[model samples]
Target: MTKGLKPTRLIADSSPVMKVPTAPAHLSRDAKTEWRRVAPILVERCILTIGDLGILESYCSAIGLVREASKHLQTEGLVLENGKRNPAAGIMTTAQTVALRAASELGLTPVARSRSGMSAQADPDDDTDNPLAVR
Candidate 1:
């Protein structure tokens, strides 16, 4: 038995499916939990459920949160027809536009990749005002 070494009997060398660690959790504990807590709220504000709102983008390869939102809007009949007047189209607010733009920029079309790479989740446990914290 060595001071810093695991006992040989306790070590089982085996290869399992890779596990991804969370982003470097250097943030203060309070801030870290607060960020995790706020993420769902932000997604709701963006008119998406937390699971569909890019939170699971890291795990899923299907259409991301933005595309889903667009689909939701379309299903709700908020789409403006070509050369047609729709009084309800005006109800599509500016926030929805921004979300759609972001989704488009992220390549949210059906052909989009479900998994791009292992990018770190934007941990907002530090400064909430940071642009990088934008979902």
Candidate 2:
């Protein structure tokens, strides 16, 4: 037999329906709230699958960290003794960056596609269940 490239086989309906997993028990209350807020949107848009729960938890936890860091920075001003920047300023910056990166990765940012080059295919006007669907 001659060596040649094999033809690719396409499976029908290979994309699995998205399912939202329960918030992980280890997540803090704020993290759980963030998960509840974001998970459903990702699931409805079919961006996240049930198997991606771990990554989802990590993203939500990062958001919680950013929130906590922001609170600390707000309560305790941006500078400490000797006019040095508060350590919490650095922590807030790092946490905010981490959270933003995670959100962009998950397509939660408004301009995420411009940065990540991943486009969401779902059309807002394509809902079949709505009797008053806009054309």
Candidate 3:
């Protein structure tokens, strides 16, 4: 992931980790994969409480949509028979916007981490005084 220790790195703190719930059944398979991938990162960072699951789901779903739309655009080409832009391209752009916003909310983006007080040059494995660290 990142080069420095994230302020959300929970293992650096003595507090117990609170794992988020498993991927929701309503999520698509790709969304589930995303859920699994980020859930652990959030857990380790101690950034996700149970209440944040909805945002997480939204992020994953948007990412899934982006993936599906990208695939559609790839297979069908970026133009329709009438030469109009493919709708899937629009879908992908919208989903990507949604995912990026949701990821920022989840502190999954570099800017978000920086906003949470994680300096880009901070040392890895040195979580002392980390603003987001579990107490």
Candidate 4:
């Protein structure tokens, strides 16, 4: 699907009969945690597969880097000697941008919601009384 296009149809009722991919062993603790948290949701939604593991790992790593950099920024402040902004702030910003970009590509960001034409109040059960419901 195109990056900014809304899907006009719902997913098939049949789930993909594929095994779930395991998280890479090289990921950091926090990255692994993130992988464990999001991988199943993507699999169940049929939006991801074993081939996409590398990209997902990269996204999770970027998230971990952002979190670590933010902690350093909180402790060390944003400026350094000679009134220069701390380099860690730049690292944090760059990491956050990369993470957001990865998430957007994976359709996990707020922009994806807009692109998919999703609304907070949308109801899946509203089809019950409609004649067009496929059963």
Candidate 5:
């Protein structure tokens, strides 16, 4: 919603209790569904906190927009009556981008997942976890 991007710092709670947040009442149906799907995993992994709700909500809302736009594109096709691009297509692209950004910040992406494990500040040179690798 702001003009530019803001930084996100994940404060982890190792061995956190499984207290998944409830979906907000203001979210669309699709957003609520997304929240239900994602909240548990984040909570179970102790990756989410009350402070992260704002971004989580944004992620869910963006995912909702993407899913909604996808339905429109499927039913109406990519072009409109005026031979212009479907607005939902743009919405999907932007929403997908936003969702991807939020997902990464939340450590939901494969690349980001590396940081989600214990010891978020692991040293790259530390191969202690790789017993089979050369020292």
Candidate 6:
């Protein structure tokens, strides 16, 4: 008489590793994913990509013309309203906005220009001037 051994079946715990909660009452999955991606990038850049030494969270959240102006100054060292450091003005520029967010994250406190033609000079010593600083 021969004894037979039982074979074991491999079991896989086929469960999702991470379970994200359902989106908020209004946000769609795509919108949430988009926000998650862009928000982090914006936040990170604001914190890690500026010429100013420090930034307040309140200022970063400030939107509209004032916020755009503030970001322009903080990031590119350009006066938004006056075109002093800037070559032009009146319309808000996306390039400037992107620059400002980046600068904010980098811990730089930008000086915003006034609408009355008050202009400020750029700090030659600011790290943003050097393209190679981040890399």
Note the Cα lDDT for every prediction shown: 0.37, 0.69, 0.80, 0.69, 0.81, 0.37
Pick by TM-score: 1 or 2, better one:
2
Answer with 2 or 3, whichever has the higher TM-score.
3
lDDT of the structure predicted as candidate 1: 0.37
Candidate 5 lDDT over residue span 47-108, tens digit each: 67676788999999999999999999999999999999999999999999999999987778
The top-ranked prediction according to TM-score is: 5
RMSD of each: 19.8, 9.7, 8.4, 6.0, 5.7, 24.3
* TM-score versus the correct structure, for each prediction: 0.20, 0.66, 0.73, 0.67, 0.76, 0.21
Evaluation by TM-score, superior candidate among 3 and 4: 3
Cα deviation of 1, candidate 5, in Å: 24
For candidate 6, lDDT tens digit of each residue in 11-126?
22233113222323444344345334344533343221222212222223222344455555567666545656564233346534644774444323343222111112334345
* Model 3 regions more than 4 Å off: 1-17, 116-135
Give the clashing pairs for model 4: none
Q: 1-135, model 4: which lDDT tens digit per residue? A: 668854533343343425567778888777888878877866665656555667788888988888787888888888866789989888878878888887875667766755532332345556644668898
| lDDT (tens digit, per residue) of candidate 3 on 33-74 | 999999998887766766677889999999999989988988
Clashes of 6: 14
- Backbone N/Cα/C clashes per model: 1, 0, 1, 0, 0, 14
Ranking by TM-score: 5, 3, 4, 2, 6, 1
Give me the runs in candidate 4 sitting further than 4 Å from their true place.
1-20, 114-135
TM-score between candidate 4 and the true structure: 0.67
Instruction: Give lDDT: candidate 2, residue 94.
Output: 83
Q: Which stretches of candidate 2 lie over 4 Å from their true place?
A: 1-17, 113-135
